[model samples]
Target: ADAQITSAKIISLDAGKITTGSLDAARISAGSLTADKLAANTITADSGVIADAAITSAKIASLDASKITAGILDAARIDVGSITVDKLHALAKNLVNNYSRTSDLTGWTATDGSIVTDATLSAPVHRVTTTTNRQILSDYFEVDPSKTYKVTLSIKCDSADGTRYFGLHAIDKDGTSISVIPFTVSSRTFGGASSNFYFWSKGGATGGWLNLEAYILGRYIDNQSDVPEGKVVTSHCRMPANCHRIRLRYLNYGTAGTARTSDHFSPTVTAVDSGAIRAENVIAGLLQSVTGNSWISLDNGQFSFGNGALAWNGSSLSAQGTFEAVSGTYLAKLDAGAVKLSNSGVELGYFSIQTAGPTGPWITAAAGASKINLAKLVGTGLYTAYQIDWGTTGGTSATHRFWGTVTLNENALYSGAIDCGAIAADGVVSCWRVEPHLDNNDRCGTTTKRWQAVHALEGYFNKLTIGSNTCWAAGSMSLTTASWASVSFGKTFPSAPRVFGQYTHDFTGDIGMLKIRNITTTGFQATIGGSGFSGIAANWFAILV
Candidate 1:
């Protein structure tokens, strides 16, 4: 049993003095007695120290394929929700070639890993070196008939032969070239260097490079007025509606013996749509006058004539008159006939009978013919009576009572009065006054008529001058006959004028305005008489001159 325990005949054996601290892991046999073995935790707790430091095959744990899976050993497994943003970046760069979304795009490029740039289609890159050689680019235009576009080409010549000429053309879809613009490359300077065309090119180490760009711009068709600034025009519509493609090209135009050489060149052509409509700019200079015989229509559905009309809507009863083009100074060709002025063949006021005068408005009448003519009173007087005669060539005095109608036409030209007081043939000699009233009484009225406030007739004269509130005269008077006994201011007197003092009346109803006549006076003195009336005291005054 001791030999078996010591394993002399066994395949391996381990012998040692069993000290509590000794560890001889190599000396132990591979298949030791199973019942004598102790648990690892129990050995470690009881001994408080490890026996052997060397690792050997006898102490290894068993490996099982069933315990292992992809989650435990897969190198690249990731939690779909918990994967970090850095992982996504690496995935994007390594998995997708067009990771920045730039693939097969003609006008775009991956400027950075994340940004795509709009590489605007420019003029073809020049690759030739020979002189007088021309290169044409392939067709890359996408014509859209739904829109209209403008083709603009901007070029500059840095240092060129002075005699060299250059030109540009816009090739339409129909194989037609339109000369949109033409400019000269005169000798100029750019970037502190001498050049043939300052605006054509910029000189650098590679040689002189020119920047030529083209874009689809817009313009107003109706604005046939002026050119606009900036690379694009916004205020005008393009012509030939719904036309789109715009092509640009450069040509050489120069005198013989001069080469048109361009070192480096770039041309940009943009495809743009029409933007918002803009108003055309007004020209800076003064506007020229435009005259045409065309008629303008008003929005209110009315057309105005070359001339205008003067119409009274009868809004008020106040008197007013209209004036047509004048024929003479104090005369007008009236519309009505001379008979239109008569009420009847019988007189109404003082005079009787009527006949047309030389310059008629109010006609004259012979006494026996009936109808009073008011124009016969030629002197400045209150009630000077003159006889109408059918018996002689001149009128003779006649006394008769009458009644008549008086028409006051505002359009009539009379300096002082429209006197209609001579109607003696009619039974009642009544004279009606219907002057214009601009106040509360807009209509004419007999009761609102104003009576003259001064009485002085010392004239058979052509001119008269009255004072502010006094009546003075300077005309010849026949002191013998009472036939010339008439007052200057009033149409009638309460009594006769005893002497010149002052005169007044209650002529305040519709009697706001006054009209007085100036006639020739033969150096005769006139007077105002109003001392007797009480109401006349407030507005009464006297002046000699």
Candidate 2:
């Protein structure tokens, strides 16, 4: 690259149409160009000398493009202030009605029958002229003159005692007044003259009702202070104007002159506008509907509904569902899910320890020992009159047994007997029976203190069963006792002793040994048999530690 220095100032240059008075055309070679010789304007496109090309506007820079094809840049960047007022007219327009111009005094308060401004009355008192105490029956209301409004007043009192009377009065904004005759009069005898009170005069006959409520009590009768009268009632009244005060008086007749004038007999007034009252009613109606069309609550302990329904008492919510508690006993638990006991898929109600016994018929844990006497064991026919005992024996080697009739009831085997008892034994103890193993009348030798084993005498009879008749006399035995030498179930005949099994006495000494021998021709060797049985002999020593 070659560099060049210039002393003169260069104003402007156009690269597209290059023109340099100082540089000769021969200096700008066809293929040789230096950056120093180039003008400030850069070239944007290549000057091709080859093929035909279509350079669309989209291919050009935005600066060289038309205003309509400027893409996102053509849109206004700051549109907030750019929008005309006409386009924002809807959003800026006021949707709520202007309340100041309408002068809606429907529920607004007024002084007497006239509208009142910011004026207020101080001692605009009532003057009653009568020999007996009399109430200022009129000229009590005053309202702002600028607004038309209405008010509600509720009055309630005990029966009048001939000395008390109520009157109505109206006071205008102009300080003018008008009075009404005594509306209520009564004697002190019948609970004092008081009546439930409500009034509607605001609409004159068209506007909605004004709601008001009050409770008046006479100290003398209703046992109250201040008011001195025990009469309370809530009443609603609608008036066309606002109210300031009400005067009450007690009239005492004849020479007694026991009448008392109430300091302020005016029933309290609650002023409201018609629109607001309507809105409040609408809200109350909605609440009632959502609350299962129940009673609607209003001010002054009053409740009402669109259906003219009144609530005189309160109610409780109804129960929605029911449930049950599971039943159980010691060392037991109900399955997490329900387990069917009968046909019904009821949840498990009880869990108890497993026991073997009859559900009914025989008494439980029958008393006495269950004995199978060899003499009573018959060879054939039905054998009845058997006994079963569930009694506990108090002895070093206690044994329990049970037995009953040995009969086969149809295809089903019915064995009705009391629960067997526990037995206690030690060493080599053998047991033999005259009947079969299935015979209900079976007795067993006590191995443990609490064993319900079965056994019987020899020769007399045998146990019978639908299946193979278990010859009780000849059968195997188990080494139930921890220490046992040997045992033989059936009586060992002289020719050959039927030794089904045997057990080893795991200890020394005869402290836990047992021996039952010396049988005549009718007697035979009857001992327990099992793989663990050992030392099977007449004089064998069976030991248990």
**Leading candidate by TM-score:** 1
Off by over 4 Å in 2: 1-130, 133-135, 140-162, 167-231, 237-261, 265-270, 273-545
Report the poorest 10 consecutive residues by lDDT, candidate 1.
188-197
On the 0 to 100 scale, the lDDT of residue 349 in model 2 is 23
Tens-digit lDDT track for model 2 on 1-545?
A: 34563535456647655554476777677868877766765644354533356666596676533646645744566565786754543213222111122222222222212222211222221222234533222223333322222232322222233332222334444544433211121232223222222221111111221223222221122211211121322221222233333322122222135432212112332323322233434543224565554554543333444443434323522221222333442122223232212112322223223223533232222122222222254666545354332223222232333244334654333343312222224443355423122211222333323333444222211121112222223223333333433343333233422222222222321122233444332233334332243433322211111
Error of 2 at 458 (Å): 31
Error of 2 at 283 (Å): 9.5
For model 1, residues 101-194, the per-residue Cα lDDT tens digits are 3222123222211222323333333322223433322233444544434343333333344222222223456655432221121211112211
* TM-score of every candidate relative to the true structure: 0.22, 0.18
The deviation in Å at residue 258 for candidate 1 is 1.9
Supply the global lDDT for candidate 1.
Answer: 0.32
